[model samples]
Target: MTYDDLLRRAAALARPGHRAILGIAGSPGAGKTTLARRLVRDLGDIAAHVPMDGFHLADAELDRLGLRDRKGAPETFDAGGYAALLRRLRDERGEVVYAPGFERVLEQPIAGAVPVPPGARLVVTEGNYLLLDTGSWVRVRGELDEVWFCAPDEEDRVRRLVARHEEFGKSHEAAVAWVLRSDQRNAELVAGTRERADLVLTAAQLPEP
Candidate 1:
């Protein structure tokens, strides 16, 4: 879906004296983050971002658990921690709450990067496993006011994912390999949850440059 349409949908869901949380879920290269950023930008200062990537396990923790190679898999994140943050967001304690954000260059989640002020009108969260039925994720949908699943063409999705890995320092060959193995697996899992989303968005139209 176009970013403008998403923003308008979110705005309608927003209410005075209440917080609105929207989930943008998709495969790794389906533009969930891009859509989330555009929503926040279009929604202006009252909007905040709270991505699920922030709950990724530290590199050390991943190593200890023998999950370093499966970094983007569902098990690699702190699902419970993410759930707790969602709970706090819903509670509306009137105090600013801080959450981590993952840095691609550092390949880790940096603490205190995403600050969700208590009074923000909107919280736009994007991630792969938000709609998954396993673990704490099952309760995640209860916290979101709306959930949109992005589904780009499969070929386009794979190409974007390969390019992203290459841009992030992976060799061309390595990028292709990762997409075929790890990324494709995650994509299949994410696709299975499309039925759970409130909206299924196909973002094929590129905005004019």
Candidate 2:
């Protein structure tokens, strides 16, 4: 889909006093966050980002659970907490609603960093597992007005993941290793959920508007 197409869909879903939740789901390094950021930028202040990454368990917690090596795996995140936040952000009436934000430097979820004021119209939530059929993820789909799956070239996605890891302080070998062993596995799992998306967009198809 084109960028203009996204804008139109976002606009149609924007209603006063109604929380609009749009899910952008894709494989690791598929530019899900990049697409979400662009949508939020185009949609302006009426839209706020509430990423699924914020549900990631802290590195220390992962270590305590003996799942540090599988950091990005489906079971490594707080899926229940994420689901509850989505429900509250979409259903409950409140003056101020707060959501967790992921800290890349610390590789942990920092509580209450994203504040969704009482009147936010659109919430662009992106993540790999939003469409997963497991557990609470089933409830996630029922809450979204629409869901778009972003697909980039597989090679490009892998390269981006490797580059991202290297930029985040991992050695080249470690970056590649992690991307192949963990990130790629997660990617495969997310990719399987494409059928659940309302639209499928290429990275280049995003419009400037």
Can you write out model 1's per-residue Cα lDDT over 180-204, one digit (the tens) per residue?
9998898999999999999988755
Candidate 1: deviation at residue 169, Å? 0.9
- Could you tell me the TM-score of candidate 1? 0.94
Cα lDDT, model 1, residue 8: 76
Full-model lDDT for every candidate: 0.85, 0.85
TM-scores of all predicted structures: 0.94, 0.94
After the best TM-score superposition of candidate 2, give how far the Cα of residue 192 lies from its true spot, in angstroms. Answer: 0.8
Give one digit per residue, the lDDT tens place, for model 2 in 1-209: 56788788887787887888999999998888887888888888788889999999888889899999999888898888888888898886456788999888777889999998776788899999888898888877878889999888788889988988988889999999999898878898998999989998875874321
Residue 192 lDDT (model 2) = 93
